[model samples]
Target: MKQGLGTQLRHLIELLDGAVQQSYADAGLDYRPRYTPVMRALAGGQPHSVSQIAESAGISQPAATQTVALMLKEGWLVAQPGPTDARQKLLRLSAQGERLLPQLQACWRATSAAANSLDADLPYPLSETLAHAIAALEQRSFSQRIRDAKE
Candidate 1:
């Protein structure tokens, strides 16, 4: 069946999300599939404020605050006074969380490989092109959401 582009992209998204979420679970990490995007945004080893996390996570500020509070309680993150703004709090992974990063990264690699293996017969370039196209669409969706909220 020749699925529509949106349907194909949705399937790809579901597959990737499942793989990543399962990888984290298999590795005994605190897995929040929705938070994966947030993790990626903060993966550069830079401290980000809670509002930054919310923006990057595509979530509400209250939601991000709740999640960050949970992560903090779990000893995965620590909060400190922001360098530029004393009123703002900087959030960074704790030493334990930092140590777990390598394992999580390995899981990501393994999961990605498994996803590729699912369609080994397809040319890799085709998949890469599809991914780029879908990413563009997602960006547009995000923009539209922001625009709608302004009305």
Candidate 2:
């Protein structure tokens, strides 16, 4: 499985993410995947513009803009004009979004517990093995991107 390094990593990531997304959807919220990444972007303690959010989330600017508009309509996000640049708007979570923090936290805990329960004793030095795997995969991705850009 690891021999096809980059492909294996992509597959694993998609599988895990799909499981997590389904879990979130089962929790009875709208549960858009964008919500989680957007929240993570806002975690940096500064309001983000749609472009910034898109870049951080690895999504397209038009998609981010659309999602932000939907979120605003759903009362989960608030937007204000940028302090220095009136043309740009800043995005942040609204009071309703803040109130959902506990729900999000609980969902994360449940997801972790479910995954951990699958193999409590996988029988390996997890940190080193996982760290090495991650580093190797990241390097592979970087190299591939560089190669692609050169082509």
| CA lDDT, every model vs. true structure | 0.77, 0.79
Over the stretch 1-151, how does candidate 2's per-residue lDDT look in tens digits? 3467668778877987888888777886656655776776776557899999999987789988888898899898899999999999999888887777667767778876876775466676444577787788677876687789999
Q: Identify the runs in model 1 with alpha carbons over 4 angstroms from their true place.
A: 1-12, 50-70, 118-120, 123-151
Q: Which stretches of candidate 2 lie over 4 Å from their true place?
A: 1-3, 41-46, 49-75, 114-130, 133-151
Report the lDDT tens digits of candidate 1 across residue range 5-101: 6698799889878767777888898766665555665678899999898897778899888888877887778889988889999988888778887
TM-score of model 1 vs. true structure: 0.58
Error of 1 at 91 (Å): 1.3
| Model 1 CA lDDT for position 25 | 81
Q: How does candidate 2 score on lDDT?
A: 0.79
In model 1, how large is the Cα lDDT of residue 47?
90
Q: TM-score for candidate 2, please give it.
A: 0.59
RMSD of 1: 5.8
**Most lDDT-accurate candidate:** 2
